[model samples]
Target: MANLDLTLKDMMAVDGAVGAAVVDYDSGMALGHLGGSKALDLQVAAAGNTEVVRAKIRTMEQLRIKEDIEDILISLSTQYHVIRPVSGRKGKGLFLYLALDRGRANLALARHRLRDIEENIEV
Candidate 1:
């Protein structure tokens, strides 16, 4: 299984990846991050997205939807943000976040790869 550093490296290899991070949604803090520029701060993104994840889960609970979230996608004019909560036993409360350049990314493939990475990661 890949460690945190390897997981982040694999994420950056995606065609249009501009930034990636492993975050703890419970605490709104990043465990590790890679590839963000001044325009995109990984730490801030991690904290903001924690709220997104929490809100979605909370809403799901209130609606009585028992299924777990597979992933959350945020599409912007220039970028695509993918938030995937890790499903492994060791990864509870953690998530992988990836930002991609819209013009260069293949969203479907990126999602598929992210899923693979998530499954194999060892936290």
Candidate 2:
């Protein structure tokens, strides 16, 4: 199994991956991050996205929808933003954020790869 740091490193190696971070939605903080540029700061992105996550969860709660978030995909002209919430008791309220170059990334493959990365990444 890949450890957190190692798995994050592996994710950064994906063809289009530009930046990645493991974030805690409850706290709006990134526990770990890698490969960010001036235009995209992983920590800042993580913090901002935490609100998105929280808002979604709250909305679901209010709607009485009993479900888990698999992942949230935000597509931009130049990039693909992926938010994958970790499962299992040990990983509650945490997610993996990956930003990839749209031209270089294969969305399906990247989603599948992120699932694998999630399985192997230890808290």
Candidate 3:
């Protein structure tokens, strides 16, 4: 199984990846991070995205939606931000956040790769 550091490295290998982090949504803290440039502070982004995840979860509960979230995508003029909640039993309240250059990323493939990587994580 992949460890946290390896998982973070794998995420950085994705095309156009600008930054990545594993975060705890419950605490708005990053468990690990990589590849943040001057324009992006991954730790700060991770903490901010926790609110997005929490808000979505709350809305889903209010709407009584039984389905789990796959991933939340935010499209920006220059970037694509993907937040994927870990599905492993031990990984509840954790998520993998990825930032990609909009011109170079393939959204579908990145999602697929992230899911595969998440599955391999030992937690």
TM-scores of all models? 0.98, 0.95, 0.97
Least well predicted 10-residue stretch by lDDT in candidate 1: 85-94
Model 2: number of clashes?
0
Weakest ten-residue segment in model 2 by summed lDDT: 85-94
Poorly placed runs, candidate 1 (over 4 Å): none
User: Each candidate's lDDT (Cα)?
Assistant: 0.97, 0.90, 0.93
The residue-level lDDT of candidate 3 at 85 comes to 97
lDDT of 3 by residue, 1-123 (tens): 888899999999999999999999989999999999889999899999999999999999999999989999999999999999998887787999999999999989999999998888765
The residue pairs in collision within model 2 are none
Q: After superposition, how far is residue 5 of candidate 3 from its true place, in Å?
A: 0.3
Q: On residues 1-123, what C-alpha lDDT tens digit does candidate 2 reach at each position? A: 676798789889878999999999999999999999999999899999998898888999999999988899999999999999988666777899999999999999999999888877778
RMSD (Å) per prediction: 0.5, 1.0, 0.8
List of clashing residue pairs for candidate 3: none
Top candidate on TM-score is 1
* Poorly placed runs, candidate 2 (over 4 Å): none
Clashing pairs in 1: none
